[model samples]
Target chain A: MQPQTAPSPQFSLRPPMEAREKFNRLTTWVIVAALLIWSWRGSEMNPMTLFRDAGNIGTLLGDFFPPNFMDWRLYVKEMLVTLQVAIWGTVLAVICAVPLGILSAENMVPWYINQPVRRLMDAARAINEMVFAMLFVVAVGLGPFAGVLALWVHTTGTLAKLFSEAVEAIEVSPVEGVRSTGASYVEEVVYGVLPQVFPLWISYSLYRFEANVRSATVVGMVGAGGIGMVLWELIRSFDFQRTCAVMAIIVLVVTLFDLISQKLRKMVI
Target chain B: MIHVTNLNKSFSGVKALSDINLHIERGEMVALIGSSGSGKSTLMRHICGLTAGDRESGQIMVNGCLIQEQGRINRDIRELRTHIGVIFQQFNLVGRLSVARNVCLGALSRTPFLKGLFGNFAKEDLELTCKALERVGIADKAWQRTSTLSGGQQQRAAIARALVQRAEVMLADEPIASLDPESARVVMSTLQELNRTDGITVVVTLHQVDYAIQYCPRTVALKKGHIVYDGPTANLTRAMLKTLYGSESDDLFGRKEEAPTIVQGAAA
Candidate 1:
């Protein structure tokens, strides 16, 4: 008691720390560094090579300066086919996905019903549309049909997953309100669940349709038959000028499609 | 009209209700009074077959039909639901749907299921709904989206749905817990009108003791999942309330200027 104790000082700008927290932070950084090294080696990533080859990319780009228009009609036809593929794929996805979406929504059904369906959807989503398109091209013998099938499978999985989440996030109180009316399970879903999630489902489907349009354009490179085949051919033949024209057309078409669909979606919502 | 005997309920092994034995005659208006987590809501839920009680603990019956026995709900509870209306504190309406459609949902069970999905509500049902909306004084907002309506209006719309359901017994779980004083008065008055005029049995859980006395003739006080008091609302003396609740009894009431010991415990 003879020695007077000092009161704690006021707060300062410098951060106060615990040694344990500092050690944890260092360990995290070490783990992150190790993982980065492992991934770089595994993927064979070399930034130096990309930097060195940057001039060749410029040279390759320069070759496409003046685009050729001789193949305009063929490009337009292929482009339209891509659009049709997108539309068909989206329609199929909507019809199939809506049911699967409802089935997979955990809140809608019990674990036994939704769990297996969700796992099956996971398997569908794990494969890219490009991979599916490649398989479909072999099976269907190379046409827009193959592209459409690939987009349909992939988009169904995606939209179903999205729609299920929207279903899960819906206000449970209204569903309870519906249940108190003695509405059957199907009736509850139709009146209570579907009405709440419908707008969100529509918006998600519209967004997925736009992505499928882009996918349809490129799936043709794997012999799934769309504008991608023409673009792929020009690239392979070193007809860079015509490739530029196709790229320009793809840009214009995708933008227009996106704009129109967005407008429609806005109106519906 | 309602019978609950030897009821016990627990969630995750924690007791929410315990040994509740209550009987209410048809056309009686009762108020359930308690602080938070006092099992008033649990009792109401049990009556409507929304939640099940402990196995081998109790049975609940409505109009001589067993709702649940030994924690098992009867499979034919759907038919029973047509006669009971449950209103929540949140005013559980499908917000995106029109107010009229939300009300029309009460008429769904009466209509064929397939036709209900297609929204083939009958002309008579629509007229009934309009009459219900009129009863709630929201006929002008019938076709408007329910979400657009204010909280008090939405609660009225919910009551209208109950009227449309032709529910004999109404269970309101803190119907005006979120509303302002003026709105709360309107909502309580509407429930009062239903009880006095239509002779509908209304069991309302209330937070404010003043409203319990002002509106409901009878109040059942619950504490720790057990009924501490069940008698005329006028008999809820300050000392009784203090015994029922502790220091927290102060917040359970509003407008304390009136004498609490004035026992107007007249039996109706």
Candidate 2:
């Protein structure tokens, strides 16, 4: 390294490192403090409420204890129905979403085609699954089919977005290598594009399937059919014991599906 | 079997190639030599119809079919590409695919459309793919994932893919630029073997002048979008290089005669 020159009479040759470090630290702290203050005000929160409301939480926890197992078979049957809803919904979503996923990717289509398809997916995702379940329940009347439709629409939007990202991130030369062989557009997608994205596509689908199972249980509360119907009814009648029982069943089933999906993903990936 | 007349290209209103004219007979191994940003790649892209030359000043013909004229690619260029192969310096294979499967992709154009989609290749395609792999000396690697292969092995697989395509003309854009000297020698020998034995026309771009003189008898040199030299490679002597590249000639041809010739490497 060059030896440091004598300090210039007018100004120093190099910056003051200590002052720069202090300034950077101050700026970071200021930003974090601003964010904390803004969120506290926006939520209308009081820090003292944590201590004041401690007893209310304890009372709720007390009511949740000593869970009842009466009609365990009925709860299991309803849990199976919720699982069925997720399965049928994911099946339909996979069918619809894979094609839309390819179409939505700008690398696969011209912007003219990709733009409208992406907008449609964005619109589908704008509304929450609960709201979609309510609308479908109104349309189809109260049933598991309504829950299926809700999960199908929501998962289709999410999975297609992920699939498009995976497709876009593939190496370009492999596609060009296929094109050099005089491949048509469809052939390019099958041979060049699909192989690169297949593992990621499978991973995304499995993840979506897991998420849909959890969502399926909640949609039943909106009159879309599942164990949430029983849970909601018990809560309304102040049958906290039965509500706890259904909640436990939901947790067990969701965990089971998560484990299955994880295993399948591991085997394939 | 390729002819280019008055080819010109510009990117964002800046000229990349101008007023280029050339012709290559069948089964000629010609080298396009140049410094960086000297229009070698641009010329190769234009020949393959991957990029269009300047409007109203260009025409290219390969195997008697018009690839492009007046900077517009012919609709039939898609069909024409079935007879021409192109290779790049990097990312030449789909890493997730098997070597055999990547070779199989080269036959997709001629296969029935549905067969290509469903991957139900004909018996002829399989036989040809095997033959191609064997020719490239990588038949043992047919079942391996492409990413597992070394750089030389992957490039050989790419060459096998081209052989499966049955391309009459091969345009390689700096195929050995990213390779070591030994691997570069192997690739050059493969191209040389294909040119000599199968009579496939090979046009390759090179930054190393010694490789060009050692492998290709004909040389075309470009400097800043202009054809500075086009003649026999034997005539590209120190005096000629000095005139074409001036002080930078040393950088282009600086490497000594340590690398073996294509024939010497092929025999090994």
Using TM-score, give the best candidate's number.
Answer: 1
User: For model 1, how does the per-residue alpha-carbon lDDT over B154-268 read when each residue is reduced to its tens digit?
Assistant: 9999999888889999999999999999999999999999999999999999988989989999999998899999999999998889987987698688765556675553321
Q: Name the top lDDT candidate.
A: 1
TM-score of each: 0.92, 0.91
lDDT of 2 by residue, B1-268 (tens): 9999999898999999989999999999999988889999999989999888888666899999999999999887777888998878883688998999999888988999998899889999999999999998999999999999988888889999889999999999999988888988999999999999999999999998989989998999999889898889999897888888987687678475366557843443
Q: What is the lDDT of residue B105 in candidate 1?
A: 94
Question: Mind giving the per-residue lDDT tens digits that candidate 1 earns over A1-269?
Answer: 33333244665565677899899999999999999999999999888977899999889889998888788999999999999999999999999988899999988889999999998888788899999999998898889999999999998889889999999999989988888877788888888898899998999999999999899999999998889999899999999999999999999999998998899899878
lDDT of each: 0.90, 0.89
Off by over 4 Å in 1: A1-15, A47-58, A262-269, B256-268
- lDDT at position B96, candidate 1: 92
Compose the digit string of candidate 2's lDDT tens values, residues A20-124: 899998999999999999998999988787789999878877887789898999999988899899999888888888889999998899999999999999988
Alpha-carbon RMSD to native, per candidate: 6.0, 5.9
